[model samples]
Target: MLSEQPYPVGTRVVVQGKRGPEVAKVRGEATVPEPQARYGAVLRAATPEDLTRWEDLHRQGEDLKWLLRARARERQLPVKLVAVEFTLDESLVTVSYSAEDRIELSSLIGELRKHTRARVNFAAIGPREQAQMIGTLGACGRENCSSTHLQDFAPVSIRMARDQQLPLNPEKLSGPCGRLLCCLQFEHTQYVDLLKDLPRKNAKVCHEGSGACGKVTKLHPLSGTVDVHTDQGMLLGIPASELKRLPDAPAPKPKRDQPEA
Candidate 1:
């Protein structure tokens, strides 16, 4: 498989064991630490001949990307081409695109097959994959996570920001994918775990050292402290370690059933 291909991390390779040999770049140790079984195996590292062929294909591929876009526009197809790839043997030309709806591309494929004289394949992608192909600097000014380290896209949502107590602003929260930042999923579990033993909001609790009973008003997971709204109508910052949970008030004894008069 592509991951198990024992060529160097960044080596250009011709993948074997498919309908036709596919050319793939070594994603390498940084992105894929462990080689996962992909669609193809490392047939061989690219030789001068292979590189020459790829160079030729590369030029044509770039043109194909634009040609597909142009053709789509000419035909009024509501799709935009994002990328194009040619297998080492020219057996397949994979074209990636973005579209709101499934715009039929059969006629487009017919034209591409004629133009490139290769088997053509179409792939529709979401904003996340679009970001992966067209990488951008993140808000942190680093390479986009999905494009660099994170290979698979994990679902991100606003709830993750809420769990981490981050400001709910779109500009700050969104990534190049125009979705909640991927970093939220990375740290969310730690925040959730830290909150498990902590008192809930408005929970009646007592500080063991001071013996003060109050309702929990605020929480600081990182600091392991929470501000308590004391019965005295004052806020007291209490450490979770020194807080003793009070048992629920016992239900009053059920009133004795009275015989009907």
Candidate 2:
């Protein structure tokens, strides 16, 4: 008697429909009804013969993948069908494929259904899911993140690029998913927090000369000197208080036309 599901004594049971030789198990008639409903009644204890048949079916499903590939080639289809999975009862079969567009798979599905005598389902997955199903190496030469252990995907944004001080080049930052890499957002909070303590780049520091203020060239937080350049292009180090914030500079005036000599 199975503890989860109540099965009548001498009833036939199938496990995953592929485990062969139906095993027979004896159960008392007084088993709880809810557990039986949830786990399903064991039809019978699986026999050794049933186990062998299940293993054979599993192998046949594996071999069917190559057959499907050959069929795709014969049909001249530009799709890569990666996985063929069958339900436990062998009543349904799902084929997973990846292609650039919505492929016309009605004929392929019809052929599979006709040959296998099982309900066929065609799943057109995106590149990420295809990579997951096929299990491939990524651009980094590492096992794909999706197939391994990344259960949750975080949203990667342009703010992450700005915070990480990375360039805004899509080719450099995008991942196998064709979106910004998840790793870029990891330390963004720390960078943003650190940036809050820094002064603006265009801030002007006080210069030593009377009535002549130098424009800020660079900032030195540790040295407390703001590097400044004068109108004549002389570079000087000025203390923080001596540095006065410079107003936004006006745009340059257009040159007047020269009189003909």
Candidate 3:
């Protein structure tokens, strides 16, 4: 709602008037920064009375949510309620539900309208989206990036795990979405860049001080370490920076005249 006086940033205001009275935080000037003003108007600043009413409405909204769920149970709705949001004006309540299969909520909505006499908005969301809306920790023991600050999700794949040299185990790679963890893609480019300078696994590499050639068995990019199978039949973890990649040994020629014997 537009205010006659500029409320500045962090100003709280009530919108939608009495029937609506939607509460919102002001980020900055309401309208687009232009000569002609075109923006929604704020009824007035959020007074102590408005704050009190907002609290009461929130409490009532929570109660109403339980009541709605109870009604759903009575009617046997298949959807599970993940979250409920009440408009400040109390004109509408939005309920988010998740289900494995298609949910026909037409009958449920009809019953809710008759019971509450208020607008009820229903939103069907995926399991990952539900977790995001409610906020959850990932298997990494940290707040989920999607719920915290990630604006969008990119397509994650098993190839991302292989690029990072991580095990292909599902439990280790899975996220709250039951798909591959999104963070696997975060530092993937850096790992790929590092791989360009590292010798291929199982290829011959020369140790600087030992004057011995060894096959690279593994790579540890973070610590710049490589596990080498040495000519002396020893497995050693050597710093990649101290080793030189060697030209591959020529393939042995196939034996001939074996059929004559």
Return the clash pairs for model 1, or none: 2-40
Alpha-carbon runs more than 4 Å astray in model 2: 1-61, 87-92, 114-119, 137-142, 152-159, 167-179, 186-261
Candidate 3 runs further than 4 Å off: 1-61, 87-92, 111-121, 139-142, 246-261
Ranking by lDDT: 1, 3, 2
Residue-level lDDT tens digits of model 1 in 1-261: 434436666778776633467566776553333356333556777788988998898898898888878888899988888988787778788888888887888978876866678777888888888898789999988888877666577788898887777889999999878887888999899999998868876778999998888888888889989899888888999998899878777767655696444
Model 1 misplaced stretches (Cα beyond 4 Å): 1-45, 247-261
The TM-score of candidate 3 is 0.64
Cα lDDT tens digits for candidate 3, 33-103 = 33433334577888987788788876766775687688789888777877666666557767778887888
Model 2 over residues 127-245: C-alpha lDDT tens digits?
Answer: 66766656766668887666654434556689877655566898878777676665676677776765454445556545545545656656555455566777767887766656556
Alpha carbon lDDT at 223, candidate 1:
90
Task: Give lDDT: candidate 2, residue 58.
Answer: 62
Better of 1 and 3 by lDDT: 1
lDDT of each: 0.79, 0.63, 0.74
Q: Rank by TM-score, highest first.
A: 1, 3, 2
Instruction: Give the range of the ten consecutive residues with the poorest summed lDDT in model 3.
Output: 31-40
The TM-score values for the models, in the order shown, are 0.78, 0.49, 0.64
